[model samples]
Target chain A: GDSVTQTEGLVTLTKGLPVMLNCTYQTTYSPFLFWYVQHLNEAPKLLLKSSTDNKRTEHQGFYATLHKSSSSFHLQKSSVQLSDSALYFCALSELGSFNKLTFGAGTRLAVCP
Target chain B: GGIITQTPKFLIGQEGQKLTLKCQQNFNHDTMYWYRQDSGKGLRLIYYSITENDLQKGDLSEGYDASREKKSSFSLTVTSAQKNEMAVFLCASSISQFSNERLFFGHGTKLSVL
Candidate 1:
């Protein structure tokens, strides 16, 4: 079985500040890591995904690198915007088990003025 | 560019009631899934279908049944609603279950059990 852990339940940051949402995962097989974002009243959508270890994936100012050695894929943004406030979920899928994705508890990022 | 439609944007049920949620997709995807989303609990998979007439139980499949009679449609039923149960049920579809395709999700149906 695979599992993902997001250390933060909520993160409040001022606009233009750097932010990082911690994410870690555990699995016996090769892992495909992903970040999904859900805004208020909207469904979750893919933000970034990566299967290659050590390669950083970026989307919409968010970036994450899959660190197989550390089992981490922390999401980071250099400068947060008001629109960046949302629920972030870290997910993992085994190399061949794309249909069975394991997701973290989720972290809500709140960007304030 | 396709859409996933989930019926009954909101659902209210009484204890011991059986409730069904419906989903349909126009992506012509080969896989469909149902997930339960609770505040701070993240999304938990309830059931998934790789193709027509196929269903596979997920980690949170207990107390729920699923039907995939058609490639474009999937339905989930809660055998017995619990008191004060509140969560969002999301429907999703991907091009194929075997590949690492991104899932396209519907807006989700909010459920409340009294």
Candidate 2:
């Protein structure tokens, strides 16, 4: 019973534009993917993590790719700033259930300059 | 390289009041967490502790109440408090409970129920 699907609640962009923040997940085992970033009030960090399926993990400049046959991990950015706005979460880590996390339903990245 | 202290950044309760939220960590972590941030319903896990005293009941533990005795503290209690409720209470730490290990947050505690 692990689930995470972010369909973007809001994502207004401008400033350089090239952004994608859609993530999907649902696990029974062996799946660890994360991307958390919450600014404005601050407290959610760690903006990139993967389990190495398609391999493409990055940080700061943002990037993600853990396609495990389409379970998806999507979170990309080629250019977009204005602090990149914030509030983007997509998490799921339930293999042995220790680092317990399963979140999604957050995608408010408004970066309009 | 360590910090996670959440203590009353802002809180004001009234409806049946019984609120408490405190957490501290110096990174000597084993495990400690209490998350509940709503506004799109992103993070939700109400309790966790894996070392000194150990207690776990995440998935938004019902009315909520937790304590960890030692291991750098971890407390959360809100027995009753609901009426115009607002939420934001996060405190985390990890160096165990491994699945990849990466959680170190604490910059929240904005609860208001009046």
Candidate 3:
């Protein structure tokens, strides 16, 4: 079985501050890690994803590197903005089971002025 | 460039009642999925269809039934609603069942059982 863990349930940051959302995973095989973002009343959308270990993937000012040894794919941004407030989910899928995804209890990020 | 559409943005049901949620995807994807999202619990798979006429149970399929009548549509039914059950149901689609494909999700259906 595969599972994802998001350590922080809520993260509040001032505008222009850096933020990191912790994500760790457990899987039996090589895993595909992903970050999805959801704004109020909107569907979740893919923010970034990576399967290559140690390779950093960036999108929309967010970046994550898959660290197989550490079993982590933490999402980070250098500076937070007011519009960056949203729910962030970390998910994982085994190498062969692409249709199934295990998501972490999302982190609610609030960026304040 | 395609979208997944879920019918009835909000649903209110009585305890023990049967409720159905519908999903349609214009992505022409080969796989469709139903996931339940509870507060602080994230998304859990309810059911998935690899192709038309196919149905596979997921982690939380105990109280639900699913049907994939065509490639573009998939439906889930709550056999017997439970009192105090409230969650959002999300419908998603992927181009294939490959581990590398990205999933596209629709605006979820919020269900409340009274």
Q: Sort the predicted structures by TM-score, highest score first.
A: 3, 1, 2
- Please state the CAPRI-style docking class of candidate 2: acceptable
Best-to-worst order by lDDT is: 3, 1, 2
Clashing pairs in 1: none
For candidate 2, lDDT tens digit of each residue in B76-108? Answer: 999999998999999898999987888989998
Chain A TM-score relative to the true structure, per candidate: 0.98, 0.34, 0.97
lDDT for each residue of candidate 3 in B68-113, tens digit (9 for 90 to 100):
9999999999999999999999999999998778889999999999
Tell me the lDDT of model 1 at B91. Answer: 97
Listed per candidate, the RMSD to the true structure in angstroms reads 0.9, 13.9, 0.7
Model 3 global lDDT (CA atoms, 0 to 1): 0.95
Q: What docking tier does model 1 reach?
A: medium
Tens digits of per-residue lDDT for model 2 on A42-102?
Answer: 8898888888899898888889999888899999999989997989898889655688988
Measured by lDDT, the strongest candidate is 3
- What is the CA-based DockQ of model 1? 0.70
Worst 10 residues of 3 chain A by lDDT: A93-102
Q: Kindly report the TM-score of the first chain in candidate 1.
A: 0.98
Model 3 residue A86 lDDT? 97
| Ten-residue stretch with the least lDDT total in model 2 chain B | B93-102
